[model samples]
Target: MINQLRVKQRDEYYSLEVESGSNLLDVLRRENYFIETPCGGRGVCGKCRVTVNGQTALACQTVIDRDMLVELQNEEKTDILMTGISVQGVLDGTHLYVMAFDIGTTTIVGYLMNGISGELLTQVSSLNPQKAYGADVISRIQYAITTDAEELRKMICGTLLELLNEAAKSVKIKTDEIALVSIVGNTAMHHLLLGIDVKSLITPPYMPKVYEAVELAMQKLFSEHTEGVVRILPNIAGFVGADTVGCLVATRFDHLKKMTLLIDIGTNGEMVLGNWQRRIACSTAAGPAFEGANIQCGMRGQKGAIDHVEVQDGKLVFHVIGGGVAKGFCGSGLLDLVASLLQIGEIDGSGRLMNGKEYRLSDTDVYLTQKDVREVQLAKAAIRAGIELLTKKIGISISKIEKVYLAGAFGNYMNPKSACLIGMIPICLLDRIEGIGNAAGEGAKLCALSKTEYEYSKILASETEFLELASLTEFQDVFVDSLKFTEENDEYL
Candidate 1:
């Protein structure tokens, strides 16, 4: 007979029947408990530690054998504000409705809000259209170099239009009701959207055609569709485009004193490090490993994706999102799987899949392969090296760093410990790290609502110093060194 576990919340008791071998993380998450397993259900982050009989044990790694009493710990409050405009109010009143878009490499998210109240009406997201070409910005840039530029622009624009229509449909608003639209994207994406040649971004001595703020009416660009004013966030440099500026605006970093680092992990891992004195920004081609691309059977963080994994008593246990059968892996799931495999000594520091291993997932026939480790290593190396190079270029030690804000869709799902374990982030900065979900989108929303934010974004564009990673010799060496996970004693790792 399966044992039952009871979870006591505020005036509510939920009972979950668990098999003898099931982990507490899977059972609790399945029962709709608000557990903070940011790395999905992986035990690596140590954030999901629950007191079992007054002793702490990782819920993801602990198996339920008998009836158990579980109490969830309260999570720390994040600093992000969740206020937004009402759709009906915006439609009925004279206030203009604004739409903000964060055109990420992996996912495209849109926000609809009242331009006056700054209240969020609705949020919508979908996979990026450029994903069909490749998951990373570099790949899309390469494709633009050889393929038709106009076609790429149309594809991205079409996706944006679809997202806008979807958001409007959900709130029962006309497309013309959207008075103002702001967009934030990487350099390559921004270039492609404007139908500009991006071949320069692909080669050495990368230079963007325009780096200042661009203001154009949506009717001018999308003449056949909507008639709202479209403002493309300005680019700071070749790599650091308007999205980084949007992040800066969203975080309000200019008002802070201590040195800060804003790291956005996606296909193009961009970082901005500085204080009130000055800020420096750069971009690294971190590939699509974190987005579940370039992996065997990898998929976006959608329904049916294996979003978490764990090892209990030398056995493999996993959970799929949407409570359905697993089809492939996502970024959070890949991190959890890698961390669990490492914790059990199934894989070494070099990320090699051990020979003669019997552990396998019940939902899929695929197992961790040696090549997957290499891909992950390459991705981690690019990110780590970018961080290191930026810190070094600014003449500051890692210890001097104050706060590390991780911004991105996957950033919200990452476990800081797993990220540190894999040498993707510095260990000393782990405690200071906080996840700010989709800061680019937040910045866009802020601009859509407030004129001050919109003006601030343009100021950020002019003030930030953009550093080209390709020009630095240290970046190349550090990138190569970081590829090898053999540096077990490195403090940053």
Candidate 2:
């Protein structure tokens, strides 16, 4: 029997026909909705939450048989930055405009700018279509190794093509008139976009098959586009792909004379520490805790996900993304909630949820379980310990760092005080921490705007050092020790 599925996404309605017994996730993925499926549709990862007939349920576990109004809990309206400064100089070197992209695992953003003035013409942001396969980089890598590798390449390239078409049409220009496209993302995103083998990436040592920056003909991916070259930024280490390199470029860390550190935390936490004299990079598999994965009642930064929380007048008050009912917790709220719990002496310094079994945000369904507290601890521990290890490798104390550049959208929205309270950032360097919003995208725009910036990144990548975090023996001990919420070991449990 045929069933009429009436889906409510944001403020719009989607009416569609489907066969009986069809899974909601399968139907959604087929329609390009890309609801998160970290377990690959095994009914795990409870990230795919939707509502059927006003009742909340997991999309993967729901079987559609009757016509019902389904509400999408994952949908949101994002005010993205479409334009930013790339380089100081610009010239009309080509006949067509330059298009840039920052391909993230969770979201993809595109920019269309003027060829002469390097001014932004238009921009757009959408969910990455590959989220249907998995959430984190490792899960996506596993999907490629076991399933069809070409599948991922096509899906991602298709998203890029959509961005390109949307951008070109917004300016009333032909696709072939686009002069060049510069792309930047993490290692898995970079490799998958180019259809490279990721076997070595998931194996021991975790080295990428292609580490250097690459330039490909635009016609190779989209034959209809112009014969311009598509530049993929260089990789600094195994998990630290061109996006990290772009972060370095955007911050101008290579030319600065003082000690600088750049940390871009996502499903994978990648950071770089150095200055003009020396540069070193590393990547930690911090898991997807920061992006609202692997925790009970966790979600991406969307409407109803508690984005901000604090202890106000000896009570916890939180602000939701859309200012409606609370559904789950996002990255920023998680950081703030944990830090508040710590300050209130509810959760101990050793990352234990004390004085109660779980922490309640409000009198609603929202809560922070003890296990959720543990997840955040592990995530922060990995990040904090990685910074310490990099500092030791460079023979410098954490206090010597002059500037700490926070890249990615999460970093931009996160509260600096909460990050410092949880020990994810050094207490001494709290004032030095600055959020550089979408630096990867900005870096790509810079490269496309000027040839000088592109060549500068290549030279910087060549001189940088890559330290394998997996190869370090002290990583385990330091991580366990860094789980404390404070530096005071005397008070920690």
Candidate 3:
């Protein structure tokens, strides 16, 4: 038996027919509706909400047993990080046009450049459709290993092709006019897009099957687009993949003589310390706390989400993203809120709430629970521990660092004061920190436009030392100690 399904979204009605007992989430996905399922449709994330027959319900848990009306929640326009520090490079002009992509776990951004002049013709961005499977890389890897990797591959590839089309269309050109493409992403994203098994990535010896640079015909990945060769940048390690390599290339980290630190805080924290002499890189499993995942009242950096919090006249004043009733806390807002709580003595050094298990925000239904503090602690500790261990291994104090480049959305938007107040970033280096928006994407553009930078990216992947923090015995002690919210200096006013 088949049931009639009507989906109402943004005042537009979409009609379809579905087999009886079919999962609403699956049906919606099959029809190309981008529904968020951070828990892979396991009903754990509570993100896949829809209206069924005039009643609000979880789409992932709903079964289409009868003809019904389904209304999908309208997706808000998220504030995606797109701009980056432009690097100077010589365009080889091998192709008339070229493109670059940064396949971030949360978002995918693409750039269209003039092949001859290296001019940025057009740029596009969209939420990674694979977030329908999971929000974090680990969950996506697990989904790929246990379920269908091909499905994930198709989802990403389809989106990439669409982005390419959108970019070309905006520039009033055909995608086939593009002659070359360069891409960068974390190892899991790299592997998944290439249809490689992710089981090894999650197992004991976590390593990608292919970490070397790859050049292939565009048609090999997408049969529809066969005009160019796609150049995938190399992956440095299991976690520190081509994205980090791209960041290094964008900042010219390998050529810098002054001691510098580069950090990209996201679902997983990837950081590199030192400069051209000896750069040590490590990845911390920071989880998705910074992305507003795994918290009691958490969400992505979307509308109605509290994205910033500050102490005003001894009162907590937070600004929502879209400026309305506060729904929940996003990463940056959560960090600032926690920092404000600590400053006001509501939260102690050990991450304990003074009043109760949950602390409700002033004039809002959103409550920051005790578990949320722990989640933040674990996330921050991992990053701080990596920073400490990396600096120590290089035999340099945090004060010796001359410049700190913070990459990614979270790193760019996060309050440096709050980050340091919670010990997520060393307070001594606060004065030197700079947010280079979307550095990885800039690296991809560099590689796409310059042959010299593309070749240099390979060198960066091979030369950077990968430090397995789990192998170090002192990591646990440092991480535990780093969990405490310590106010290192009173100078950050």
Candidate 4:
């Protein structure tokens, strides 16, 4: 008889019989517990620290034995991004209410709009519950394959249901009254949400199982448990999912006369390079460093997390989200902090902090360590290198690209100047950078509100040429050079 493993998550406890040698993380996942596993249970990222009988251990590395009592670590409440969803045009009072969603790896945001008046009624943001499995797409994909894809699907569906209940309650409406929901996410989230076969996404070439817009009845996902239609915008390619396509739609990439680059940086760096005449896109494995994951003292945007940093009179000044004292560094704060550190010579060209193994940010219990710098180095390199490759592919000089539309909540919160100062983006594109907050969700709203816009998304996906970043010969060399943050590599552009 297999021994039963008892897990206490938050306030609830679970009793389950597990395979004698099964992984604890896998068992926790099976029971629908959302334990933070930024490293995808590979045991590399220590974010999945859990206590077994009051002894700290990585859930992924610990196997079920002798029915141990496991306590999940306290999770940092994710400060979700909710603004920048604008409803334009007019609403039809007769039309049913619509919901638009940007399904991100780290967070999920939804907009409840009045279909008739074209007014946004309510906006809700929540951490992607699937984050318990991993922090990146590849990890999530592996989780789906290793554990159960339906498990991943249920987490998202449950999260969506919770958000819907909240939104409907906020407006004294009914969840069943929602007429449509349009979703935009990267390829992995897209596939997992629909319970689509993700084996292709994990395999070579990473081609999507399907390449067209997907429309399914909510009843299909919920199996007669809900009403309304769920329309997933078409994806540009396997890695460049509908979120990229939606971002392009949000930024009006098709109508732009000048060469524009739309960058939506998250766990994956998806960017589009094009003008009204030509368009191309690519997905880079930028990792979750920019979102404040995979770092020893990093966290998502949340209360107690440092959100910004600056140097005042040769002293470090930092701002915390929901301010009191800093607990850890969020993406924006880390960027600004790194930029300031780089500018002040605290960190060298190769991203070595001058203060030694760890540099304390302030008198608060916050610090930036050597390992943290490496995380940022890898992340910034992937994104900057992708930007460089894209520009090169478009055959345009860095200065010639007229506008850089920064999409997603990270882009909105991050200081463009800091992003440039740290070389996350070329200094030349500094003046042109513009943050389009929750642009993917907004694009989904546009799709839900208009059939014409929905059709245009298909055209945009068809026109987009997905550039495989791994195929380029110059990519490796550029990535290596981009790892430097010092002014010594001034010719990085």
Task: Highest TM-score: give the candidate number.
Answer: 3
Per-residue C-alpha lDDT of model 1 across residues 49-110, encoded as one tens digit per residue: 67775678878788888788776764322222222211221122334688888887656778
Could you tell me which 10 consecutive residues in candidate 3 have the lowest summed lDDT?
484-493
Q: Estimate every model's Cα lDDT from 0 to 1.
A: 0.74, 0.83, 0.90, 0.83
Assess candidate 4 and give its lDDT.
0.83
User: Which segments of candidate 1 are over 4 A away from where they belong?
Assistant: 1-95, 311-315, 356-359, 362-364, 486-493
lDDT of 2 by residue, 14-69 (tens): 89999999998889878867577866666777778888999988998999989978
Task: Give the local distance difference test score of model 2.
Answer: 0.83
Q: Give the per-residue lDDT digits (tens) of candidate 3, residues 1-493.
A: 9999998999999888889999999899888898877777788767787889999899999999999999888888888999988788777887878999999999999999997888899899999999988889998999898888999999899999999899989989888988889999999999999998888878876878898999999998778986789999999888999999999999999888889999999889999998878999999999998897778788889999999999988889999998999999899999999999987789987889999999999788999999999999999999999999999999988889899899999988999988988889888887899999899999999999878889999999999999989889999999999988875634443
What TM-score, computed on C-alpha atoms, does each candidate reach? 0.77, 0.91, 0.95, 0.91
For candidate 4, report its TM-score.
Answer: 0.91
Models, CA RMSD each? 14.2, 2.9, 1.9, 3.0
Candidate 3 Cα errors over 4 Å, as ranges: 1-4, 15-17, 53-56, 65-68, 487-493
Over 1-493, each residue of candidate 4 has an lDDT whose tens digit, in order, gives: 4877777767778777877888888787777677778887778878778898879999889877766888875566776766653535323354569888888998889889888767789989888988887888888888789878998898898888888778888999988888788888888889898889899986888799977999989887655346678888998877899988887777677888988988888888888989999999998888889787878788878888899899888778989888787888889999888888876789988888897898887688888889988988888889889888988888988889998988887898999988888888888788898887878887888887776777888999999888888888988999999998847335531
Error of 2 at 278 (Å): 0.3
In candidate 1, position 81 carries an lDDT of: 22
TM-score comparison, 1 vs 4, better candidate: 4
